[model samples]
Target: MQLDTIKSPGGSGSEELVPSRYAVRVGDIEVLVVSDGVLPLPTQMLGHNADPAVRSAWLKEMFLPQKAFDWALNAVLVRSGDKTILIDAGLGSDPDLHLPRAGQLINRLQATGIDLTSVTDVVLTHMHMDHVGGLLVEGVKDRLRPDLQIHVAAAEVKFWEAPDFSHTAMPPGFPDALRAAAKQFTKVYHNHLRQFDEEHEVAPGVVVRRTGGHTPGHSVVRVASGGEALTFAGDAVFAVGFEQPDWYNGFEHDPEEAARVRIRLLRELAGTGEMLVATHLPFPSVGHVAVDGDHFRWVPVFWDY
Candidate 1:
């Protein structure tokens, strides 16, 4: 395949298949952006800021009524040649998060005509269950099948698999069920795979680059073919501050390191004018980053269908 980009559907922030199903293609690669679901955030999740009343009013002005912030989880699926690579699973919403859409990743996969049995690789950007929630099904507690090469950063694996990790101390932002589900896969994933290097190749041109910061060993997957490239940025730069291009992620283990990597990543993306795919960049989250004056601005490219 020379190179092809197909737009699917339903993604609000990216470009893909349809208004309901999200998918895009570049040359021999077919990347599907599927939504786990959406959530509403309160001022606390926004960050410790100014007056609550003032902020709440400001949020209302911005159309964020009900004093909530809404977010969506879009998992990426890259199919090239005979391999199917899943990048981060949607948040395991279920009873853990008291939400129901978290486990729709597999459903979305099947809807895209990609079979879970054929997915040879399950790549994790970090230890956050939302990013790796779909590795196992909702009810198949012990009947897990479809052998896979689960790739993770050694540091991330160690962090999640750490025996001393306080499960009860998991951030309130994440669902409790998600944490429990993660524990289940601890032994299983350890038996199958471990951490990856700074630059590890998964598929032909698909490479996992160490852009650690969000987590100690967090990484971003870069897909390049026929001179066309796209990066799957997981939680590095959320939408609000990403437009600023300089604001540090509140959740990053090391904000300074995260900012530095974001700068380098943006500079590279802008230089190449390659497509950028992000987990939190909005639906159909495919776009380009450009240097604007002294700052960088993310440009969402629309598919002309």
Candidate 2:
């Protein structure tokens, strides 16, 4: 399938489904954007401290839809030589999410002619439900590729595995199902899991950096090959958070620390012109971050087949 073509439920020209796959070549590495699906988020979920009036006005000025915001659930597939690395498993095959249209990562991969059995490594940016939920399918773990090496931060494993894990610090309206899903993840993948700290290289060209805030072990994956580079920027920043580095995400466990890490890393990435693939940007979430005075903005790469 071409990168620009969207294959969904109803054939072509149907609005029910958006393009779920995009491909870009960064030097010697091939990056594929695999989308599970889009989720409808309430605009009120944005955690900016602006007054109601100011927030409403800002949304109007941006010409955003009055109701809900659309957040794309994206996963990055990095093919470097012989290694096939998947960053952030999407909403898996479970139909329980009942989300309008989600849990399509494995199907989308098959549609794109990518073999699931060939995926050698699975690196999770954090333990968010959307990122780690796909680790298991229908309550069964490692079903996709049992031998796959699953990598995550040591702190994240510790947080999720604690017997008395608490959600007190999580944002309002956070779903308890996520905690259950994470517990299952820890139980099933414990044997295949590899925990790493900062600057640990997982693949030939991929390195993990500690950029916590969203979660204790939240981190970003940096891929460099043939003098070109890109980053899988986990959940460090989202749509408006790009422009307002101080804005906290409702899902953040440590809002203060999340802001600190987001601002600090964004400044460096923006200054360096490093390409980044956001987990929750629009489809084909790859983009470049530009420093806009005291804040930053996302400049999406032009679409190409």
**lDDT values, one for every candidate:** 0.66, 0.75
Please, what are the lDDT tens digits per residue for candidate 2 over residues 103-162?
Answer: 677767766666667788889999878888766766334346777888899888877765
* Off by more than 4 A, model 2: 1-17, 93-97, 139-143, 162-173
- Pick by TM-score: which candidate is best? 2
Looking at candidate 2, the ten consecutive residues that score lowest on lDDT are 163-172
Worst 10 residues of 1 by lDDT: 1-10
Question: For every model in order, what is the number of clashing pairs?
Answer: 30, 0
lDDT of 1 at 23: 60
lDDT of 1 by residue, 1-305 (tens): 11133323235444443353456767668777777766555534443333556556645664765455556677787887767787887765445456563466765655444556666787888767667666656553233444667787777766554432331223474544444656766765667674676778988988887777667678888887776778898877666544444444445556666677777888888898998877766777789888888778789888645
